[model samples]
Target: MAEQFNFSSPPFDLLRAAERERLSEALSVGYYAAGETLIAAGSAVPCLFVVLKGVIEERGEDGKLFAQYTSDDIFDIRGLFSGSSKHVYCAVEESITYELPASVFHQLCGANPDFGRFFQADLAAKRQLARRDGQNLAEFILTRIAREHLLPAIEVSAGLALGDAARLQLSRGADALLVRQDGELGIVTRTDLMTAHFRDGRSEAEPIGPLAHGPLACVELGDFLFDAMILMTRKRIERVAVREDGEVVGLLHLTQVLSLFSTHSHVLAMRIARAESEEELRGAAETLHTLIATLCGNGIRLRFIMQLVSALNEQLLERLFELLVPPALRSRCCLLVMGSEGRGEQLLKTDQDNALILAEDLPVEQGLALMQRFSEALLSFGYPPCPGGVMASQPAWCKPLAAWQRELNQTQLEGQPEQLMRMSILADASPVAGNRQLYEGLRQGLLRFAQEGERWLPDMAAAALQFDTPLTILGNLKTREEHLDIKRGGIFPLVHGCRVLALREGLEERGTLARLGALKARGVLDEGLADNLAESFELFLQLRLQQQLGGARDGREHGLDVARLSRHERDLLRFGLHAVKKFKQSLAWQFHLESR
Candidate 1:
């Protein structure tokens, strides 16, 4: 058997000696009788089976055949890592399987970075195909809460008097009050009392009980913010009591979360908005670099922080435009950012790419003058002038809704490669302010036109595979002595691959992270796989920021060198980079890019 099989090749060739032994042991020879259901979808099981002999078919919930498992094929490890009961497909067959328990597999892989990378590479390949067929998309990528501060929860008994609660609230400078009553929970907030007493003629001293409200929604301390967001959205509540079972632990409030965004974002924006001098504005821009550091250090989710920072930038620019642009033009149009800024994925400041989409039939010269003023004001607010000169001040980018739509339609047909490349940025276009509907309409038209005949995706997929994964011919890991551009190499593959997937699927979530999640929900990508991509993108972003901050500290723009990364960071990067490589390969094969 050993002589017949090629173990000296990839994926098997990638595994370590210890890992090979573990795999052999895990693949014990056991036979299942015919008509046996080996594993069911959505079951929280500890182990995944690899076929040692016989065969199995993966079936969907509708009882239709999906994929058949044969020699060397793997199944169910995704579920093992996901720690979720939602299996995307079911296993069926009387088969001999090598059972790999999740715990042992995790330990074996953890100790061997190469072995772990090998498995992720294989999984990523399968996931790309699953993405197309809507089968095996979910790949598990771990997430950590990025919050820097967890404020202590102010506690009070449900029976505590209003006065005592008030004192506790004031003493602690806390906005939320948690009430544990009779082994259950409830809450009486400051707003609850202020409205009740002042508006409803209730006495403040009247036991806060009359106003207390709950079936106290709570989250465990260890649960991620994704968990917290789900609980908040599902319950329509502004706060959740952080709990260890029924015992009151801490409290998470929406205001606090928003404040976290504010601390890292709004302060710089506000400074920029209020600055009256060039020096002050430069100082504000310098402050922004620090805020970026804090946000990354706190482990803030890159996606959420991006949106928050983008919103603050919009606010800052809006105020600047109000101060600089003539009032009449401000009333007629808004300064909107397209592309990365539009998608709320921007972290570090790059180039300024934006346009003015004016209301129809405005006096042409007046509007042009207003845009000039707006562009100058943006410069004052620290946005560098666009190299492509697509700023609102540029007449080429500033147009009526009808003209913009026509331009987009023409770009699709002209098929000039350069124009098409420029058009790609349109995918990230988002409206920041005035005449937002106009921006939205233009975006819809572009999406409809680009994806309508399914003409754009194949080309986009073809372009996406242009970056080859830097895998060595001898199978040794490649390390860059100079900084590796994770954004160009790792992030772009997933971003462009996801964009093509979203366009094909008609997924309208414009942000890269949101698009991935939406695609997962639509079953175009699996939840676990989407999680992996999202996590990888975020980790890369986080590392990039760290590199930038270190450069800022040293007064030099030190590029990211993968070789310089700590052992643990390098291991993670290898896993993430390999995932991107395999995903691109999957895209190539699925869309027939290589053959084309």
Candidate 2:
């Protein structure tokens, strides 16, 4: 028997330990001299080849470079299984490969479904499997939350006196107590008990039910800790009751959840909120890359990761505004995060697209100065200045409520290309802090303009169709400079198409997926189409994030290197581009853009 094969890479990594041992026993080492033809095009593949040393070059029928396989790389699985090789595999250098015989491969496939599926699965299926594998990793936060991590629910009868309940809780070392009252359960935290006793001047003899809060926030024992953290953040509650089969099993405290993830978004959000100075906020912002890498590496769904990043970014912006602007000034203006940040789709810290909507009758100079300081502080805190000057620091964007409304009306009426772009940016604007009423007034005006100018939607939607989807008729990517612009080709169509639909339907949502859902709910789009668009948009986002994380030069222009993607990923990209084409055609038909 040869040395044991390393099962640390994909496809092989999907195999079980026993299966790896079987494979290790069955595989035989083979060597090829440079330029030797290993597998000829149009010929049958005898076995799967796993490169052990040196490199193999795969060439098409025309002798074009198709792909390269190096150490630890597997090749010809598809050809071996299908019984027909599509490309010529030749050793580019003196190469050694561990060959798994066709019989053993067939036996393994028959024995292990997962191992078989890993080679045959489509990109989406492979992505799901990868996510499952990530979930199984020891470092993923969700994997850390076990049965032992949950604190047992300490219950007390509602009729019991507060003093007795406190003593019982203390004896049990419980941070909270579940009180049973009128055949229903309520939660009373230690803080609640203390507040009841110290602030409300409640007597020890008083019934504990009066201090209990219900209906309590509850989560299932099997729920992911990430979900629990989101719930806690949304509810602004410190504790959630854990239940199983309609029975209270335990209580999950925020502290315990935090303990499971030290560098998680929630902790970073907390740090951002607590930062007293620009330097402290900078420290928190600095951890964003690590957080993103960890989450992405763990295969967390890109959409959820974007939402978490958006939330943390919002906190950072809000904290920066608080630290920069005086209370009186802050209250008078609504700080709006524009563009991707405004839409809650931004994954990385990009440019700062923000505006300050001041209340009527405020001095423009004072507002400008405050905004300048705020924008400068954000720049210091890691947000780059907007290239188009779409920032609070700009006098044009830092405007009073009436001015904003007037500008919206002007842009809607004019409908010029630049004005349309401006309107689109404003359409996705979401307020991060300050006066909500002012922001709402501006939003209502914008919506009203959209209603009045429904004819302009065709033109707005036309932008989505500007760039041809970079997909060939053969279902391969048509690339310029070996790269396909994922953003302009795929993301823009879905995002702008959703935006136009949202505006026409009077939807208030800013996020592309949310707007799609709203459009579906409003009968503007069917469930199937909406779902396809959502998945397509998500795929585009994931690819774009991967490209950014991969350190592509000028991410806005260069896009994703199509050649660098895995075979399944390329297939997924093609599928996503087809979705974009469908969306574009839908937009054209719906808006009657073709007639224009």
Candidate 3:
């Protein structure tokens, strides 16, 4: 017998050791000459094939290659279950393959439910399985809040004296106390009592009710630890009241959430929030890469990681702005992060694509000087300057709100490609620091322009379909110089198409996935198509990240070498690109851009 092949990847990796051993013993080895047909179209798949030391090409009826399976690749799961094949598998080179008889394969599947589901499930289910595997490795973050030992919620009457409330909280070793007033509940933290007692020079005999804040941020006990972390991040609060069935159960603090993971996002967030100088923030920013690497290595979902990182990045940028700009001037300007950073999809620190929206009366020159210094500071903090000069340092991007509205009006009228692209970029703009109202005013103007400029929608959507999807008519990846531009072919179509739809629907979501959901909710997109687009977009992002991590040069658009990707990854890329093609077709139909 030939040596047993290792089943260490997904679908196969789900098999139990005993089952694998049994299948391994039943496996036989076979050799094929180059060009030999292993599995003919329409023929019953006799055995599950695992490429041992050769390459197998799966060709369609027209003899066009659809996929290639190299060493360690498994094939024919769908065919085996269906009892027939739609395509013929031929050896691309003289090859050896491990053959597991269909009978034994069935037996192994029957014995292991997980193994069966892995092979029989759809792509979405398989993705869920993969996520489960990742979650298993990082289960601490996924732990339910109810599972942790929680402090009892110390209760105090509404009219209790400050001194008595303080004594009760301290004596109970409680960090927070719940106060009942007018049949409503409020929370007073130890910090609140101390501030009222010492900082304000308040009499200890005064009632504590004034110190308690009503309508507190609270989370259900069933929420995951990660949910609590997000709540804390967004609310800018250190603690939240944990509720169980509408009753206060305990208090969850930021430190408690941080204790669950070693990534130290909580610590980084604190450092960014507390840093008063550029050097301190820079030190904190330097550790971000290590944290990202750790999270990625642990198989944490890229989406969750991106959210946490985006929040932390926003904090850093906000702190930097505060340090560089005067409080009075900062209040008059709105700092906006455009493009990927604004969309919260940035996995790596790219360039700074930012703008500043100044109040109508502010001096443009003064704003420009402050922005120039801010952009330079970002470069020192590791963000490269935008190659297209989209940063706030550019005088044009640092314009007053009225100037921005005029620019939008002019762009809508001109409809020039460059101007339209700029408009599209700004459509994703999100306020990072300074006066959010200024950004909101500018955004409302853009939305109104988008709504009234119906003719511009097609032109904006046309960019999405400009590049041909990197798939050939023969069902093969179309490549130039043996590389595929994943962004142009897959990412942009979904992103820009969704942006156009979001604009039409008046949705404020900046992220592509979130926009898809909003579109689905607004009935602008079918649920199935939305789900497919979301998965496809995620696939593209994952592939791009993988390509970048594989040592692609920074500061330039990167491409993926199809030959270098694993068979599974190649299949996913093909599926994602096909989704992009469908998305483009839909866009053309909706926008009437097909004739163009």
Candidate lDDT (C-alpha), each: 0.63, 0.80, 0.82
Best model number under TM-score: 3
What would the per-residue lDDT of candidate 1 be over residues 1-596, giving only the tens digit for each residue?
32233345334555667677766665444467766776667767656565666767766677666556665556665666677434343335556665667777777668766655555553344223212121211110122233333545766666667777777888887776867677656777779867876789776567776677878887776666545544553344677777665566667776554443334243454566677754565566556556666655655546655655565556555656566666665656756776567776766665677877777866656667877866775566556678778677778777777777877777667656665665666666666656566676677776676565366567767777776555444222354765575656777778888877776776677777888888878876667667777777777776777776766443122246765565335545666777677677778876878776
What's the best-to-worst order under lDDT? 3, 2, 1
Ranking the candidates on TM-score from highest down gives: 3, 2, 1
401-453 per-residue lDDT for model 3 (tens digits): 99999988888778888888888999899998898989877877888876777
Show model 3 residue runs off by greater than 4 Å. Answer: 1-4, 53-73, 131-137, 147-149, 154-158, 170-173, 179-186, 198-200, 213-215, 243-249, 474-482, 546-557, 561-564
What are the C-alpha RMSDs, in order, of all predicted structures? 14.4, 5.9, 2.9
The TM-score obtained by model 1 is 0.58
Query: Best by lDDT, which number?
Result: 3
Give the least accurate 10-residue stretch of model 2, judged by summed lDDT. Answer: 133-142
Listed in order, each prediction's TM-score against the native is 0.58, 0.75, 0.91
Model 3: colliding residue pairs: none
lDDT of 2 by residue, 1-596 (tens): 25856665556667777888888888899889999999999998878898889989888899888667776667897798888899999998999998998888988888888778877765455555545443532244445345776887988888888888889888999998998888888888888888888999999999998888888888887777876776776555788888888988888888887776655566677788789988998999888878887777667777767777777777778888888888887778889998889999887777889988998867888888988888887777667888999998889899899988888787767778887888888998999888777899888888897788777778888998888888765345789988887888888888889998888888889999899889889878877678777877888777777777778322244378877776446657776788778778888899888875
**Model with the higher lDDT, candidate 1 or 3:** 3
